[model samples]
Target: MATIHKLIALALAFTALVVVVSPATYKEGDPIEHKSLTLGEVLDGDRMAHSLYDIKFRTDVPSKKVLCNVKYTEKMLDVLRSAIEDLYYFEFVLDDIPIRGFIGHLEEGGFLPHNHKIYLWAHLHFNIEYNKDHIIYANVTTKDQLPISLDGATTPMELVFTYSVKWMNTDLSYEDRGTRLRDNSFFPKNLEIHWLSIINSLVLVFLLIGFVVIIMTRVLKSDFARYNIEDEEEADDLDSDDNGWKIIRTDVFRFPPNKNLFCAILGVGSQFLALATGILLMAMAGMFNVHRHGAINAAAVVLYAFTSSKLG
Candidate 1:
């Protein structure tokens, strides 16, 4: 009975380990929480009546189909009337967006009415100003207001949508490059090849190489190989000499064991995984931005220190 209990415990532990290591599918709009602090600001309150808004929310990184709608009473400013149309495109930056997370269809993501309603009350505010020389200043503010409804319970989720509006020829210019880059950057872009496929391919390649080395070593060291094959002249010579013992294949004994090569390959592969994961974590911490000149190196070193704990 004790032995059976031990076996059961071992089996459970092995199963848990397998599941933890396995790669699983994670789509955009999945209920992942944002890890970084978020901030947004509205700039340029007047001149052609421009408005800018920035919002930061704890949300699933790179959410699919981020629906943003601006609601305000229409007033005298003509530019404000056509604010969504005249100004430059809205900029939505995903802070710490997972490198492997991708955007997909809402139905494909399995978001229900309850989840959609959580974002219903969230909105951005646009305050525009027009100056004498046809210069426009826009200050967009974000606000949260729940619609009155007696029937349903309010959603528990807290959401922040960080955004900034820039109106200029340069802002318009970025539309092509920025939109193109953003669209291509997400994970599952090749929707057919999921995370499971990549992980499985790596695991299978490693296992095949390991097994081949193990099998070849075992086969070369076995005694049964001595009787299996020999050139015709060698066999005849053996018989003529009346040698009772069979001659082993010389090819099998010719080479020494290459355990070092096998061990080195395995060890390097494990280290490569650790290094790759650490680099990604540091990148997400915003320590290695090409534009950030101040203390970037220091921040990266500190982040590396924290990640090094895992290796030890």
Candidate 2:
């Protein structure tokens, strides 16, 4: 009874520990806290753009070039139309570019075709120029405009704007991947320390969980041994008799096992083996620095029927 209690307590404690530790190790929140938008979504379109006026000066370098692109949805057509019609420049303060782009409206195909839902698309360009000391800095801002309107808006608008920027230092060498393709010299430096700190915290949590598990397992084992009673021992000894085995054989094996139990055990075991093997192969490939193209899951079953033949 004591051993059973200890085992139950150990299981409960381990479960509780896992629940607490696992959450801390891996937690994902809004990439941009105030403006719940990812880098990709922010670049997608401006109408959908979250109101993030200040590009919190994370990190940047003059020598190391950085490029940024902004895209706006069709809804932005109204804003642009109002800007162009007003003649007064709707000043958009860009921190990095150190300037603003004056927007305007034009006829269909004046910028690009009025596609499925888009009124038009615009592009903005930034080229780096240097001061007298040859210290490179963004020197020019090129404003490209598209004229358009949106269906969802209560009023008519023109020119939806979307822009992409790319910057490269002639001085630096770097590899190009889908993500993190910036020159390390200019890469957001502050984020490096912050992300590393998060990683270290996760590692510490994992180690603490391991230590807790070890200590709890050892303590429970000792406790169980100390409190184990004598009556259950005698019962177990009696249950080990030869007649017990005979009774089990007659009651269970005599029926050749229930079909449901046989199928369940066989099916579950086979599936588990197959799944474990697949996971092992995938893990091995990943460990060896191999990229997994895809995963394959398979299931198979064979059925057979038998007939007896008799000879006279």
Q: Pick the candidate with the highest TM-score.
A: 2
Clashing pairs in 2: 45-71, 46-71, 46-72, 146-159, 147-159, 148-158, 148-159
Q: Clashes in candidate 2: how many? A: 7
TM-score of each: 0.22, 0.25
| Candidate 1 per-residue C-alpha lDDT over 58-160 given as tens digits, one digit per residue, 9 for 90 to 100 | 1112222232322222231122223222221222222211112111111113446443211122333323222322223223343433332112333332233
Off by over 4 Å in 1: 1-193, 219-273, 278-303, 306-312
**Cα-based RMSD of the predictions, in order?**
23.6, 23.1
* Whole-model lDDT per candidate: 0.32, 0.33
lDDT of 2 at 201: 99
Model 2, 1-312: lDDT tens digits are 011000000011222221221111111232221224333323332111121121212122323222222233344444434444443222122221222333333333334655333232234444433232232333224443344443364433222233333444543222112122122122236644477888999999999999999998886675454445368865564434333223355566554558778766766666656655655675556431101111222111111011111100
